[model samples]
Target: MTTPPPNQNDIQNGAGSSPPRQQTVALVDDDRNILTAVSIGLQAEGFATRVYADGETALKALLENPPDLAIFDIKMPRMDGLQLLQSLRAQSALPVIILTSKDEEPDEALGLALGADDYITKPFSQRLLVARIRAILRRSELVRNPPEDAPGDEQAGTIGRGRLRLDPARHQVTWNDRSVSLTVTEFLILEALAMRPGVVKSRNQLMDAAYNDDVFVDDRTIDSHIKRLRRKFRSVDPEFAAIETLYGAGYSFADG
Candidate 1:
């Protein structure tokens, strides 16, 4: 059970984990039910929860203190989730999963385009939410601390394809020597494509590379991520076209 503080705004809920390194998840939603239910749900999975009544409060605290991950509801007063996401993307690459009450593709597409790692519709299952948080956290951790034998040096474990460089250990990518921030999902997807330059990777294959077996994402999700990836690369280099789409097939990478 996650017990909110006296005021509860921008504050951590539940008992503190001074022993193990517990990841904290910030929930920004106008709905009290969602805040309370999701808080307890995340606590049950050994994660600390921070509940915000709206996106405005969450954005301020998130930028100052930050969290392991954040879930933002699309509709909110003071500031909406998409606005918060867009504002946050201007400063941080914090892993974010947006919650949308509407079952519209446009919302999902816009969120993804604005640097959200994932999006979930309202009335989502607690198990699925917890699963997504864990999956993204795991990837984030791997990027921070790669295995000893995983090519950690300057020249090792880094895949260089012409002007693009993929560093699996750091979960980083660069185009034309300029840095490009990508979400955990985007980084993994790009890594998959860069690892095998000419070989096309289907949406299913990409979903496998980035996500765990328990969590599932569809083809459109992959497509959205790909679009964002291109947008990000193009931000650094306008002529960026390494990511190729083969109609009726899949996507491949070719830096040249």
Candidate 2:
């Protein structure tokens, strides 16, 4: 596989001109094929990428110089992604996305509990990965610099129900005044439910609210996100019961 030649404007800009710096994504995986393929795919889509062949090496560079986002693969030879994530979470809140083996919930739950923003099952589509990257990045942007006029945004503005409060403009959530850190996907799903408290939202509806129409996400993905949302809130409020399930009828939020 050959790399495409550099863009003419990129060469000119690097030579003597100034341009906006590309958003860099760091990818850590032991598989050289995955590292090479994903890095190329991301670059072709207009991103700067850094790839590492193992978790131990990636962890060091990540601490010294973080990227806008990171994608980690579990089960690395040297340091394993989970340990690296635990260490990084202790020092930084840099947004991270994870890759997990197919149908694996324990690792997914553990990663999300440790503050990962999103996860994609293995054998996933590059299109889906790119879509997830774009979604999380957009949400990150909203958190950093919110616009008052982006009200049309599904995750925009503030929505409150009982002890739960969501300030999408700031990417902030609180349960009974205690702050809760949530992934963009989690926040969006929660936002949808809280927007119409007492009303049930099917997984499909929630997905539509959180993801672009072009991207296809299975129902299990939404279910996992819901599980993480509950787990995060419960960490702060042991009696957190605002989010409810109806079994075969989707989920809802209790305003009272």
Candidate 3:
């Protein structure tokens, strides 16, 4: 019996190798100059980009059909990047990178807290941005198109720790039979933790999981996201505050 070819989803995920040249990237910013500049840059890099002048429009487009990746400026008219990220977190696991004009740590911290996968403060190098985008795409590709497991491992679908269940195939997460909405960054962080269960994952590890490359990312960026993730768990199931933080060490997802 000849093995059948990989499924369509696998092809779409870049699993079978003819990586498409035209990938959709949604760029959101109120400034026409910034929007035009980013769209042009991405287009030059062989990506098809959609420019939105406001977060509201971007969110609507995302809900209609998710993009390969999304980059949003933090400050915008009407809905801001944070709000758009929050909404997108509920609907898709698309990679997100946030752009901001503020260099303040607090602003950076807040953007991370709001579910941005990576934060780029204004006056950033375009080359660096493109590099980061490529890195994020590579990482997401792994999750979107998982490796074929050895015969025994093929049966596994749900990765669980107590009541938390991560359904990698469906990209759905649940706690006590109820679904949990996590941003792409949050899901990747959780997946990394759950893969090891009792093992503690240092902040750097989590950072690498989200960004997929060794670049200088603020340590506080991790802390802010963790705080936000913990709050989300607390809201869903109070006992879920169990995701432990080992003062100055790192974090571990284990049975509470």
Task: Give me the candidate number with maximum TM-score.
Answer: 1
- For residues 57-77, write the lDDT of model 3, one tens digit per residue: 788887777777888888888
lDDT per residue (tens digit) for residues 68-160 in model 1: 899999889999999999999877888999887656657776776676877888788998898788878877875545566765536676888
Clashing pairs in 3: none
Error of 1 at 251 (Å): 2.5
Query: lDDT of each structure?
Result: 0.80, 0.77, 0.72
**lDDT of candidate 2 over 1-256, digit per residue (tens):** 6453322111111224333756778888877678767877887677777877777778778888877789999879978888888788656666788899977777876776565777888988989999889877977765545666666434565677778888878888899989997766678889999999999999899888866565456677678778768878888998888889989989999998
| 245 Cα displacement, candidate 2 (Å) | 1.2
TM-score between model 1 and native: 0.78
On the 0 to 100 scale, the lDDT of residue 31 in model 1 is 80
Best by lDDT: 1
Better of 2 and 3 by TM-score: 3
CA deviation > 4 Å runs, candidate 2: 1-21, 31-46, 59-65, 73-75, 79-132, 144-156, 214-218
Q: TM-score for model 2?
A: 0.68
The estimated TM-scores of all candidates read 0.78, 0.68, 0.71
